[model samples]
Target: MDAEYQSFIKTLRAGHKPEFPADAKSIEYARLLDAQDKLSFLRANFNIPTRSPLRKRALDGTVPGAVKQLDISNGTKHVKGDAKEDAPSIYFVGNSLGAQPKCVRQYLNAQLETWASIGVNGHFTSLDNSPLTAWQDMAADCAQQSLDLVGAASASEVIYMNTLTVNLHLMMASFYRPTERRHKIIAEWKPFPSDSYAIASQLQWHGLSPSTSLVEIHPDPETMYISTEHILSVIDEHADSTALLLLPGIQYYTGQLFNIPLITSHARARGITVGWDLAHAVGNAELFLHAWDVDFAVWCTYKYLNAGPGAIAGAFVHERHHHHGHHHHSTPDPEKGVDVVGYLPRLAGWYGADKTTRFNMDKVFRPAEGAHGWQMSNPSVVDLACVRAALAVFGQTDMRALRDKAVVLTGYLEWLLMGLLKDNFGEPAFRIITPGNPLERGSHLSLLLRPGLLDRVSETLAAGGVVVDVRKPDVIRVAPVPMYCRFEDVWGFIEVLKTALEEAR
Candidate 1:
């Protein structure tokens, strides 16, 4: 421990906080805390960006902050061109996009070398030294690696496939079987826009009016917080007519981690299919889709999974639904379907076909059992490579251990912000919109700055190399991700934000 903190603790032993500024208020205190962290070593697995090249945007690295017209389809890439001289940025936006894993480069390079050496032969061949499997088994390989992350019953219960919304669309195709009497879908009031659009469009496509068929459980307007009780009441109100209940495991904007097991049990008992948009929750929160009996779930890996932007997404089809979805006689996606031998009805692809007969050139479609049956196309091998690398870091530790770190890390950030945001006039400049209860949140804390202070605060924060998600008009979502963020980063953010607020005032 730092001498100052040690002294402070001695003072606290006498039942008082140290009066000196050198106590818990110094960067040394943050450093002391970081020095004791067991997970601090985990930070080395990521490529943190240095301040000097944070704005690079061109092939020759010329743009600043302006969105570049480059091929970022692979995802946001972080670098350290001037890392030697400059300090690393305090990256607190993992809730938006996670930092690039250091191993992603190695994994991608392996894929490239294999392809160059043995073109067609690479599909079935994996180098002994490579950290990946043969091309055909890549998605399943990722799923196996992710079983513990999603809390699946077995490898067969999980699969990595299309992006979040597409998987949602696919899962909804089978699970959102609407009848004349039970056609309504229950959702939260403030789902990420894409989710809202997907749900509405699905209703429209089914010839159902979204105005009547989509039931949104409204949040308390003053705080924009959705309570578990409110969600339950909404489910009760529409239980008989609701065919599906889809909500985010963690609300992206508010960072509200829903009570997955409770909500799933409540809705499913009412005969409603339960699905979760776990885009922000997968790697951020502890999940038990199988144990909780979730009907299905969809998630994007770009956020907390650190698999880069536009990474191949993931889906969970509870083992119970693997073969029985066709019993509902749901409508097909039209563009991609085949008369599969399996009992379930899913959009089929050659790659989704059972491997034994995948090369048989037969007309009959035989989907591999369980979640693999849901695959719609050949997954991007490069994307799978990135996910493999990301999972490798996760493979070193489980979510239980990560969650323990997250609670303390985010709690430290909240504790520091609450104590430090005092202005000369006495009233604080911001209020935390995310729930203070640790069980109800994940890694993010949504700080709603008092009206009119956002612009100056954001400018200062960006200038100080403090990356955060800014919600225009007032809020900033700061995520102290346990995977790579430090207690020092949290302290740095608070120091920057506190100064920014004082200056704005």
Candidate 2:
């Protein structure tokens, strides 16, 4: 391992004193943490799934007798060694797919009712008894709610739009302006596949080869964590030729939270546009995009935000980019001819046209002010409703409170896992690849397990009702979301993991 990473781990181990007694694997410590937890009540806001008897039977390799002979009461059948009907599974996959909120159904039902009774009028007119306004304004309302989450200076700087990859393409269309002298794009060596593909294709669109036009920064071979120094060094090395620097706010695999403000300032100083893929960072980290002066950003709502699958994503364009002096027109500008000062090239659509003259059907395209000017079509009202429903739960508490609880919750999980390793194997059976500093990472922890053991460990965990996600090769990622997960859940996961490891061995 690199000297920097070794020192980091040593400092992490020294700084983290166990909050519970040495016998932290016990349930008593778990319950004590739960009792003192201020956010415990929030867990009731979600609908956690219970293990079904059939699932348990399958896990245990048992076959149920004739289904017709089963006893049924209150819509639940009696089965031997059945799990309690209301018991929630120990969910640790919030980083991948957050647990559904109970209010989603309520919000969807409202939209359905409005659509049924109001018909086409629902597009522009609000139903009398409904909480939602006209369907046309749904995206705008959701965008307003997301402003604080992303720390935008104004609602106009943020917009609710298409999926992550789609929005990424849109942002790149506007921001990735390559020049002869500065045509290179700086990015991580292992970005999410979609991001890599988009960047590569963008280079190809400009008739440039990926090998020469792209500069990817790799982590030290020994320590998987990429150091901030290394990232800045690459930026400085290619400052003269780099046109754009695109990276994730929180690395998807390692759960490392990059220094956004620091990197943005450095890139902007070099006269390079910077963009962030905040898919994992949106609700997971506290961001200040406007204050940091990021050129642009895009994110998906489905992961930490708890919006349903394929939920509508969001985008950010700095307010300085909203200059209206360069509106597209049929006639050339009388004063400056065709070249307008401070104009950004956008793939214009009618939805992005000025609201006042939008329906007038003029040939000239007068773009709407700010981020809304980037919209191509009306967003899905159903998707906006789902996002609004999820944001409502977030409205109950501020990000600071949630993040504060997260540090303790995740630290507790890490402590218990370390204790398990020491007591059971007396050596490192697995290594935590995620950065140990609470300030440097989010809620998820990525464990790099022994070779060929990840699948067996994950399967054993699933059989025991502990749900986590396994990345390819040898990593298992677990996240204890602060909003819904409890200290007891972390403790229970560790105990189950110990047993799972033993079974795998």
Candidate 3:
């Protein structure tokens, strides 16, 4: 740790919890905390322009204070009105949806205006003189960003598409071709509801019973996170009949960064087609899909990527599996019990027309190279514009610098929460379900509230204007997004949390 950090810790340990302004007291204490480094890092890494009109309005200076003072009895007040103090709510639900960057609105508006002026002929308009409706290149650009995020070899191997479940279903249609002998799809026991449902539906569509074809991997009885070693062992045990292994890059509930390389490697070695749900991993962790030889993966851009809710999602197919210029290396072997119809289903639309004569023909279908081959419908123009705006920030920033900042910010948040929990509720009031090791956890910390305090604590925190989210029954997920969240935010969160706990008691 740096000297500044050590000094800050000393000040924090001195035991004088900072005081927040009474009008919006919950967030004021954060200013007293030594969060300069964390805040500086965010300002440095993200293109958070303070002087821009878009940013100025999005930030609405002083709104954060109002958020800190909000009461839940009033009901989700952030959207209720124009209260400036309500801005710094210390949002922790990046796992659900990320706060919008101030710049995205301007970007979207530019596109909207361009569309309005050019009308139906916007495709060949003068400004850029490029086809506005041509989503092909947009898909390619998003693929490149997703590739860098997941360590894929080429842009062609990835594709941007609909939401997580929709993309998962599409990939399953192409990859999860199961046979009677090796037809089981192995997934986490508590996999996100959408994933579980999609996998079940895919199996049912193939005339197979989910009970016999779906394999759910459970963690040890009392634990929420799965053990990497155990997952590999299960794959080994079920290798004979396991056709696919679908796992998440990070467990959403536990914030556990699973051993992607090891797990995917083992499954692939045993002829299992491995895919990943990266809803929680895409922008939070470093990945190496190409190096790891993962068959495919999908993610939602709304979370850490800061794309708007229900924004366009992304998918990655290993370059080895993509037929960019050449033919597919080899069809998945049938002995592995993966079924293939020997042809990709065709699309019926003007965009799907064969490129050579597409302009002259009303209908034709010519599959593009690699993962682009998977695109069936036109991309969402608005969503792509927002994502393009977000990726522009990444273009200016290095992931390594962001990752370094993340380590400190998240670690500090965890440390403060544990300390506060110990001081008030004693040892076992709540447990950090997110791994203690930095390597095992990502930006979020999932705190498992003590048995009976879950409801009251959650309700109290929201009423107190603490913007963390709770998974029903026990888990409270707190994310200190390094790009936007400050160390002061982390400190303030703990203070409010302690007050909430006391109030609950």
Candidate 4:
């Protein structure tokens, strides 16, 4: 880690977060920071949507980085200042959907070609000069590619399969085995709706009442900050009765990155299984699932991962959870037809079977070792291709580099936002709900605006070529994605927000 980042980490650990540098007040400073950024070259790999394309409801054969001219008068000459609508947008919504990677089109086409050319043979055949591996190995290939992103000890610990909610359901099926004494699940106050639904549904499936089984840890009333100490205290309170401790690695609404290691260790020490929903944190922040001794974790690939929306999600199962076998009867049972093989119980299917024996057509189940065993079906090759292309972009650089830049980029954003603390009439416009500490958050900032300003503010920002996520009831999420967003984008968003505030008022 850079010394500055190391210091920031220490400050975060010590609970002594200081404010961002006050000097980043000018657009020139943002440009200077951009010029000095080592990872700024990474922006070219992604297809950042421009203002015109973003507003377009129908596809016009237009793609980012491609010039699409229409409705030209007199020799199709370009007009100065009027071309602002065609300029690249300050897309600050990677928290919702990341900018597309340029390689996705090629990867998808290659997969489509393989399907068209070889049909069934494409599953096992590795084509020449191809960007993707065989379809059969696509999930593993993506998992191997993601080892560093999620910090797994081995590729086997990570598996790319269904969407995040499905993975969570599968993980709970295996890890959320509640006994009479420990039927409760400890969760943060607010989880993404999918997670809350999954957790609650799982409890219902297990013949347990959600009211009695679900224990939620509420955050601070003022800041919406869920501290590590508070989480640990909640775990302590329900230690014996809690079967699972599930929390988001980063809160989706607040963008508050949790202390995963500390929280995981604390819960696991009390005989509670730890699971993290890294939907926001996986690509936005650093993770160490294996090292943290996390029992399991789940994440989607769309946010900060540059994969298309509803892209294949991934999960991590500790090596200890990967059971090649536990205990099995040598003889086939007369009732069951095949010899029973003992392993971690999951909602298994043919895809989870070992590749060697997967097509045996026998009734016997031989689960694949590691997280892959949790898979219920063969993944979509199309989804895998998109994931592969996205991961390929990440393969060019390590998480440390991305995170290092994000820390600075987000700090610059905060520093600038701080200058706009109040309007010209001297009233506070909005309050940032995300933590100020770099180590305690990710690339995005969540601003809780004053009442009645969200819709108008959102409209003004859209008109000004600044794309952001406005979570209704007055919050705007601006995420300057480290992979494609520039420091200038951050500066431009603040400038647009300032204007929007003026107009909204």
- Winning model by lDDT: 4
Give the candidate number with the greatest TM-score.
Answer: 4
Give lDDT tens digits, candidate 4, residues 153-243: 9999999999999999988988888878888999888899988999899999989988999999999999999888988899999998888
Q: In terms of TM-score, how similar is model 1 to the real structure? A: 0.88
Model 2: per-residue lDDT, tens digit, 1-505?
Answer: 1342234334443545334456557788777777766678888777665555325532432223222432333455444554454356788888888878878877888899988988888888877766677887787778788777999988889988889999899888888867787889999988999999999999999888789999998987666788899999999999998888999998988888899999999989998889999998888888899999999999998888999899999999999888767445434332221224535667778878777777798777777778888888977889988998999888888776677667777888888888878777555678888888777788899998888788889888887778898999999999999889998999889978988788777
lDDT of 2 at 326: 49
Model 2 segments beyond 4 Å from truth?
Answer: 1-20, 53-81, 329-342
Off by over 4 Å in 3: 1-87, 124-136, 324-333, 336-364, 425-427
List clash counts for every candidate, in order.
Answer: 0, 0, 12, 0
Candidate that beats the other on TM-score, 3 or 4, i.e. the better one: 4
Tens-place lDDT digits, model 1, residues 368-480:
77888888787889999999999999998899778866776776677677677642457678888888777788899998988999999999998889999999889999999
Q: Candidates' lDDT values, in order?
A: 0.82, 0.81, 0.69, 0.85
Worst 10 residues of 2 by lDDT: 58-67
| Residue 189 displacement (Å), model 2 | 1.2
Q: Model 4: which residue pairs collide?
A: none
Please report the TM-score between candidate 2 and the true structure: 0.89
Models, CA RMSD each: 6.3, 6.5, 7.5, 4.5
Per-residue lDDT of 293 in model 3: 90
Model 1 stretches astray by more than 4 angstroms: 1-22, 57-85, 324-342, 422-426
Cα lDDT tens digits for candidate 3, 60-131: 332222225334343333434454332456566666777676557566766777778766554444346332
